[model samples]
Target: MRRGALRPFRSFLPGPRSMFYTTDGPHGLPHNPFMAVMVPRPIGWISSVDAAGNRNLAPFSVFNGMPCDPPVVFFGPSGQHKEGGPKDSLRNIEETGEFVCNIATWETREAMNASSALVARDVDEFELSGLTPLPSTLVKPARVAESPVHFECVHLQTVHLPSKLAGVSALVIGQVVGIHIDEGILTDGIVDMKKFRPIARLGSSDYTVVDTIFSMIRPG
Candidate 1:
């Protein structure tokens, strides 16, 4: 099958009204269809330095980058930590005021997923994923040395959102202070995404990659 192609979908909704449904009540599916319905979501492989200056890494599917002038990125942890309170990434970023958003690619997808495992607060995810942590230029948080691109950012603010479960669900907005890109992925000064092959989250237990390319110019 071609890259980004979708399989035939069979819906649980009945009759012609199937197209319309409300999320306020259960749709009678095996799993909650919220995340999957959103299609491919950007993955932010975030790294931060703890109080001990130890590195922590985690993958957030609910992450995105804004095309603002100065550039900005946001990510959030959906649940409480295994040890309690916020996740290490949030705690460390709030305390240290710095973090690095590593671009997740097909090459490091396995390692990125491995880092998402819920473990103790003191656990080092870089070691858990068997990836090297490189020092960032402007941030105390380490960068994934193997990643093709990275955005070093500082905490701007965090807005708490309603959560259906225990603990806080917050959206953390960060200001991008620095960026690092591997020149090898560039083609004649243009950043070739086909070579980058960044990965994204697609439904539960599934992921997709930017392995294909197409173009569409805006109508003038």
Candidate 2:
């Protein structure tokens, strides 16, 4: 049955439409579904390495670039996995103080998703995901060769949010030391978003493509 077709019969008693946009706590039917419906969040294909030289890669929707003089980007890693403690990827970054954020495209979607597993700290996601790694000129961590854009970053800060949806969540901020854009993607010295065709996180088992785009100009 179509989801929309069956919607009118079922009613939401305590939802955004009824609560005037203010709801407390993180339980009940009013939590996850609400955030997921906000839809089409950009994916951050984060890559990091641990002190023992183990590599980690994963995808996250809680990612955004901070527009500052030198450029900074941020991604939030769940404090713990569904099974246990913090994911090794974020922990590795915390230990090494460096990471690489790769932009995921339709071409690398499968590989990006493959790395999102609950693996041990010694395991290498690059090997498990079957993606080629290119040596980074500026950072010790390697960049995914298939990705068109890569941001080599040094860890800046982490905000621990203990009472989030999960018992563990950390907002990691990084300063961009180097940026690499594939030559094929460069046009008139600008990186085209349309050409990127980046995949975005929607919800559980749902994703969106970058096909329809619009622009706006801020008033002076």
Candidate 3:
């Protein structure tokens, strides 16, 4: 298959139905399906430090890579916390312009969930979750020691999205200045998914793990 080539997907299911609704309108469902529809999103276990040098760790489901030439990635924090402010991760990134993106895996799921608790600005999630923090070479924030992969990033900018709700959401974009990968997960020089065993977010409190692998060559 050539680049930009189209592949037909044949489905035996019924044809699509009109179930779309405006963002401002109600979907008539018990829970919004937006997050569920974007199933299995990569979790960015973000670590940062405040001006006072207090470390902060949090997991953002709305996170992913943005570019490759400069190796960029981003995580978005939506809504204000119970403290009535932006998340500590976002605030710390703004304060110091540095952060580390740690890849969350099945083994660290519990710790990840614990770190997501809305704690105070001075609180360190590493200690709260009982996870070890490894010093980063290129950033002030420490990387999750249990995580197999880490991206030491320098904050580039934050884009705030207009929202109808009281609180706004922002995307924190950063340039990956350094990366650490565990050699144990490498298979023939490539990171093996089976060994990595990464976990991802789903709707509500649901999560899924990556235990299976398959590949297909792109058409050229």
**lDDT values of the candidates?**
0.89, 0.83, 0.90
Where is model 2 poorest over a 10-residue stretch in terms of lDDT? 19-28
Scored by lDDT, the top model is: 3
lDDT string for model 1 (11-73, tens) is 676887655548666667776688888879989999998878988999999999898978999
CA lDDT, candidate 1, residue 142: 88
List the candidates' TM-scores in order. 0.90, 0.82, 0.91
Clashing residue pairs in candidate 2 (N, C-alpha, C atoms within 3 angstroms): 79-168
**Which numbered prediction scores highest in TM-score against the true structure?**
3
Better of 1 and 2 by TM-score: 1
Of 1 and 3, the candidate ahead on lDDT is 3
Worst 10 residues of 3 by lDDT: 11-20
The full ranking of all candidates by TM-score, starting with the best, is 3, 1, 2
Candidate 1 global lDDT = 0.89
lDDT of 2 by residue, 79-176 (tens): 57555767876778889999999999988999988988777666678899999888887777889999999999999998886653665688999999
Name the regions of candidate 3 deviating beyond 4 angstroms.
1-18
